[model samples]
Target: MFTQRSRCLLLIFLLYFVNKISSKVEFTNIKCNTFDPDFASFEYCFLKSVNRTYKYLSIKVNLHKTPITKVKVNIAIFKRYNGYKPFLYNITKDACKFLLLKNPDPVSNYIYNGFKSFTNMNHTCPFEVSPQKLPIGYINQQVTDVLPVPHGDYLFHSNWMAYDIKRATVNVYFTIS
Candidate 1:
């Protein structure tokens, strides 16, 4: 036995809970471009789908120069509206310094944690690029832990820089449903 206002409030709460529980994040596409081929080159960069429900992103970069002492990464997120417009997140971080942190910033930590398990860039300064292609991906894993955002298409754009020079850019497209 509930009043009208109480029933309406309960229904709203249930709807919110259901929406939160059913939300999922999936990678739709990825694009990579190198600004300086002499410094670095993309070996492979693409989104891979294993099945209808499973997909992953894979990327590899071959660095011509060795012992990269300084590295920085810029990340920006965009949501599709009339076109693509900037969303909530835009971050810039020194890669080496961030790797050394015991407890990093929340935003950077969230982004790093998402791909840390699949990346070889876990160590601090003086990175020696190996001859082999370094693959970074979340194989067979669906991204569940993510920022709470409305269901929409998103673009995660990142710039990889080394030695104060922009080396490459990666654009990852995803959808939340």
Candidate 2:
């Protein structure tokens, strides 16, 4: 404990650990499309940057038809290596049932936890239009804590379907560093 070399080594190790824990996830871009505008349409979807280190996601969807009885969502994540390739997760869930669960599947719960606080689609189905926008304020540390990946580029793709018909698709591009 008195040796200068040992102290230096310990300091270096602490710094590395701190940096690893403080790593952040940043939104690079977002793309959204509505296949059938009569059912639903995107009002706006984009990433906002306040500074080099601060960025947030903002998206809004207008539901033209109210009280959609049944809805399903398909989510897939990809990591970039030369080009985007499938990474860890690919799941499809019944939106209504998933939302009402007491404890959902681990993977779905992990992913949904990231945006649950920021979106309005919280309760079970019979979903209706919301006048306000869905602003996913920021990607917080809670999300990073559950992520089991190194620094890299990732894509989160989601397809929304209602009554067994494809309705919309959203692609979110982000980087963890």
Candidate 3:
């Protein structure tokens, strides 16, 4: 029989591998870039594309709450040709990450944005799965909201710390098509 510590270690190892295998990488639309002057103060904003084939925006959550209750998310999108046309998509929290509140209220006073790559290099392209080192700009966000990315571009905003979660990393994987 395995010892308690051994079992715990095994569980942790399994969870780590499971998280990696399950994580999906989604490419961001570089053209639809926006700067959220309100939230992070000139922070870069990206509208990521999502679909059934390319679903799952993997985000890591660091939590201080013994058991997290729910996560809140804000979402926005951009029109392809409208020049910052405001669009929105509904995100469903994936069970792979954590459960979300049944009734999630939208957040104001914050604009969502992040890093996106239009080119894919064998070394570094997908922001989350790339083996190459990430530059100063490509950083992960805290507790994020979820939704099936629409056929267009979208922006997301959330505070992981709201649920007592902090210091987390998020990775989004794309399906090879």
Best by lDDT: 2
> Residue 69, candidate 1: how far off, in angstroms?
0.8
Error of 1 at 170 (Å): 0.2
The candidate, 1 or 3, that scores higher on lDDT is 1
Quote each prediction's TM-score: 0.80, 0.81, 0.25
lDDT of 2 by residue, 61-163 (tens): 9888877989999999999999999989999999899988999998999888777776777788887422232233345475455554667999999999999
TM-score of candidate 2 on Cα atoms, chains taken together:
0.81
| lDDT, ranked from best to worst | 2, 1, 3
Candidate 2: misplaced stretches above 4 Å? 1-22, 128-140
| Candidate 1 structure quality by residue, lDDT tens digits, 1-177 | 999999999999997886566456777788899999999998888766676765667787888887788999899989999988999889999888988999999888887766776667667886632212212224212233344567888898999899889988999888877
- Regarding lDDT, does 2 or 3 come out ahead? 2
Worst 10-residue lDDT window, candidate 3? 121-130
- Give candidate 3 misplaced runs (Cα > 4 Å): 1-26, 29-57, 80-83, 90-153, 156-177
